[model samples]
Target: MTRQLRTGFLLALQFFSVIPVKKQLPMEKEYITAMYAILPLLGLLFGSVLTSTVWLLRDTTEISSLLLGFIVVLIGLVLTGGLHMDGLADTGDAYFSYQDRDKRLAIMGDPRIGAFGAMALVVAIVGKIILVAESINEASLVWVLLIPVFSRIGLLALFSFTKSAKPDGVAAFFQKRVSHKKLQLVAIVALVISFMLLIWSATFLSAIVLIILLFGFSWLYRAWCLRNFSGVTGDLLGAYVEGVEILLWMSLLFFV
Candidate 1:
């Protein structure tokens, strides 16, 4: 059990970072569960950094809102190594490849960025910065951390429900091993914990809105994939996760 917990933690870290675990950690049913559990913990760490940065900037200089926003965004992208940025790029390439599903997926697999991909990356990053800068709320910044974590879980949901379109990739392994029951449990636990930890009001209104939006987006994406591709691929899953995160942030920013 101890070994499994360590392996799961490693897996979660690897999933979010460029660092690779050398050995094949034996997969247990709890591996995905652990990933879901550790997600908010990671979010908390990143949130702390951003929140600190924001407060420091607000205190340190009378920077214009536009400049401060840009700086905050720059710091965030640097911290994450622009992980979602890559996802946005890949997604744009795939979506605009002007080819068949296979060809589109192949485009996404390429390391090179196309014009469409570049535009998507610019829009997502800039849009996020603008929204965060304008809001200037500490709680809102903290909630932004959940964007990446929950979005990744949304990707994991796609993996659980669909098959890989190719023979090898990150999604391949997860798709092969992650089960429906495990994914469902992970989703339930993650959502519950998110609300429990994020509670700022007695009404729990914000949490309820977030829950509805997250599940609604997940189910809608699943249905769209079924109608179009018949199965989800690594690239498509990446796109879904990033897209969902962007929309989720937008919703939270405006609604909550």
Candidate 2:
């Protein structure tokens, strides 16, 4: 059990981020399920890196908040290797194509980027930088740490509740291996932990509102994916992570 859990963490790190994991890990059912279960922890790791970066920049340098925000955003792109951003681009391209479901999926599978994809990437990146710049201050560093954590919690919820759009691909393969009950339990525990952190750093009311918004957006996004793609795909899941992070950051502008 310990070995599976450890390998699962490594697997999640390897597949989701730019972290180096040289040893090839087993991709068995238990390990893959464990990988999905550990996703929020992965988000926590990312949050820590981001929080640390903010601290280092603010404490050690005289950089402006706007530049600090841009650096933080750049670090995120570096950390994930823009994996989710690619998904966001693909999703934007496919959705705006105004094609049928099959055609949209085909566009997503293509390696080439379209004008819509480029536009989506620009808006998302610029929006994230501006929002982070506006939202972060000395009192609200906790919000920075919690934003990715909640966005990932949203990811788990979306994956648990939605069906894969196709019979093949990374999303479908992992979806088959996951135990929805176990994944839900993981998400619940992560949510509880996140709430505790939020309450410690901010108001209980704020915590409640953030969670509500997270899940509500996830529900709505699930419906949107269903309407457009018939179900979730790997690309759509990536799009959710990017979309939800932006939403969480934007929400902090209100409460934090």
Candidate 3:
């Protein structure tokens, strides 16, 4: 169990971020399930990096909020190596192609980006910048840290509840190995920890609103994925992560 948990943490870091993990690890069912189970902590790590960046920039520099927002977004892209963004682009292209399910999946598997993908990337990136610029402040840095946490929790919930669209790929492979009950337990614990963190920050109202919003969006996104793609894919999951992060940030604008 300890070895599975350790390898799972490394696997999550290796797969999701630019963080280097030199040693190769086994991808057994237990390890893969542990990977999904440990996924939200990956978000916590990202949140720490983002929060530290904001703190350093705000303390030392006089940059405009827009530039700060841009920097924050850039750091995210760098950290994840644009993995989720690529998923967002592929998802956009596939969904907007208006083709059959197989065709849409094929389109998503394509290396080239389409007009819709470009547009989706533009809209998502620009929207994030604007929302972050507007919402960020000293008092709200905690919210920024919590945003990725909630977004990842949403990702975990989506994965636990939804079936994979394809027979093969990262999403399908991991989904096949994961234990639904264990995944649910992890999601509950993550949510509880995040909620407590929010309350600790004295943003009790924000905590409630964010949890409600996360679950609502997760449900809607699952339905959308099932209807459009037959089920979720790695790209779809990535898109959900990106989409929920933005939504969470936007929601913070109301309170921050």
Candidate 4:
């Protein structure tokens, strides 16, 4: 296969979802860099999968909204192999461990789960269900559809704007290759995506303001990651993604 098509944004889809793509052998950092260009689509694609299932459930089955929302969350977990969920857990354990930075980084590297990690996972999972269910009940399910997109927008921003904390972690490779120009392109991509998704929502004008606020909120977390962890890591990226997901849903609860 040609390099352009082979290494294209398909890498992002494969990286973040269960969906298969023709991955070129010996993956290149360039592929990853290129993938960041379309990160919003990754979220949009995932959200499409979610909303498709939701439509099926609502139209064909008699499932309770809360239960259906729970099921949707489960489908998401399966689709992403609980990718960000694991990050959320590890981040929780490491950050709340109260160890010095070095020790905390080491704790994050360990394979075993800590109490804080497990608690974080439980809270995130349950919280997502409640928020999504509320959206479903309000017939504002469109918000859920776009949340995966918004969460990814937040993730892409986090990845582009921050340095990596660990030299050898997965995030480090991309950090090294990402240029100032590339980051500028990525920010534009994210803004365009935000506008597209926001304008289509139920409350159009308020969505414009809300999305700007959301982006601002994500930037604050980027600062926090730098201050707390020294920079971003793969685990930290995942935690940010999950956090943005919840924040978007919660914000919608008030706005939608």
Candidate 5:
């Protein structure tokens, strides 16, 4: 169990971020797929990175909370190497171009940023900064800390449950390589963790609210994927993560 966990953790670090793993670590695709279980933990790590900035600077007279919050979000971007954000950009450009589905996929494959992509990037970045700051100011550190954790779980759920649009790219590789049993177990674990976090931070009612909304959103996103690109892609997954992360923050402000 220890060795399996270590292997999964190492693979999680390799896949989710640009962090350098130990030279002794193996890069097994099976481990990479199994590593989905660790995404929530990886998110906890990320949440710590962003929240530590607030905790460290909260007592400072010169550093404004707003600035600290922005710094935290910026640090998050750096931590992840902006990989998901890039996907979000590409997804926005591709999905909103109103072209044929094939052309849209082709657009996402391109390195260039379109107008829609630029707009989506601005919204996501700004929304993250603002909502993060608000949550901090609200002293909702628990929610902030768990937001990434839940978002990662959300990402894993999307990857596991949805069909790959074109059976191409990294998303396809993950879908194909991950075994069903492992995927189901990991997703269930993540869902259980999500419920625990929500219940810990808020009332059971609030937790139930979130649970219901996520199911609804998941169905909607799946439908959108079917209509737009025939199925989900890495970019769409990233977009879902960002969208859900911010929505989770906002939802807690009212529901929690």
Candidate 6:
């Protein structure tokens, strides 16, 4: 494939729910840079789809809030194909089992979900359902849009600061593919856009608080990883995404 076509393909694979581009693109710098660009765009795409779904359900029929929330969940699952869900499951299985660092890393790489993963998945989904039900608003939904984008942006911090505990897998691909300078640039852009979105949504203060909290959590995550596993993994990135999204909603719901 031409470089441009390959780059676009990589972005599509990394970012969008539509057009499932199956083959993994070459782990090039351009491909990795495209990932940061593509990642936030997925948030925008999902948010737009979500807003439309809510409007359609609200307008076309008398959908109950509970049912609507379920639909929203399904839409998210379909969009990302449960990518983050898998992350949550893996992280939970690894973290909560009280396994040693090497064992935890090994378990995280396992495809099978354990009892801890199952429970964590249930809790995370239920929490999302409740939050979506309560926070369903045109404005709030717009802020809800921030969850995926910022979560992926937050992934960059993990990639930037920590070593990959595993020598192989998705984490290795990203670490090899993306450079520090490119990751930093993408993060700055994502954060600036995030702040602007917050301002636009009239939640500027909440946005600031959220960023600080994200950094704080990132530090804690890093420390925990070092103490236990000695470095971060793909599952940890997934956990970070879900945890941060939950915290963001909880903060916005109660504090903002």
Please list the C-alpha lDDT of all candidates, in the order they appear. Answer: 0.67, 0.88, 0.87, 0.79, 0.79, 0.74
Model 1 agreement with the true structure over 1-256: per-residue lDDT tens digits? 6765677778766666444667666566667566544554555565577667777776677877667778867766665566767867987887777678778767878999999999998888788777666655534554655655566556656666676666676666665565567666666676666677557532377777777888899889877666555567655665675577667657755666
Q: How well does model 3 score by local distance difference test? A: 0.87
Model 5 off-target regions past 4 Å?
22-29, 59-63
Candidate 6 yields a Cα-based lDDT of 0.74
Kindly report which residue pairs in candidate 4 clash with one another: none
TM-score to true structure, per model: 0.80, 0.97, 0.96, 0.90, 0.90, 0.87
- lDDT string for model 6 (154-235, tens) is 7776777788888886676677766678667867888898878877776667778877888888788888877887877777
Quick one: best TM-score, which candidate?
Answer: 2
Per lDDT, the best of the predicted structures is: 2
lDDT (tens digit, per residue) of candidate 3 on 65-162: 89988999999999898999999999999999999999999999998999999999999999999888877764466777877788888888888888
Over 4 Å off, model 4: 20-26, 139-141
Model 1's alpha-carbon lDDT is: 0.67
lDDT of 5 by residue, 1-256 (tens): 6777789888888767878885576546566665877888899899887667666676455676568668877887887888889989999999889999899999999999989999999999998888766666665566667778877877887787888877677788777767756766776777787688768876889888877767777778878888899888888888888788778767766775
Prediction RMSDs, each to the true structure: 3.2, 1.1, 1.3, 2.3, 2.2, 2.8
- Which has the higher TM-score value, candidate number 2 or candidate number 5? 2
Q: In what order do the candidates fall by TM-score, top score first?
A: 2, 3, 4, 5, 6, 1
Of 2 and 3, which scores higher on lDDT? 2
Lowest lDDT block of 10, candidate 6: 9-18
Candidate 3 stretches greater than 4 Å from native: none
What are the per-residue Cα lDDT tens digits for candidate 4 across 104-197? 8899999799999999999999999998787775655566677887777677777877888999988997777655477567767776766666
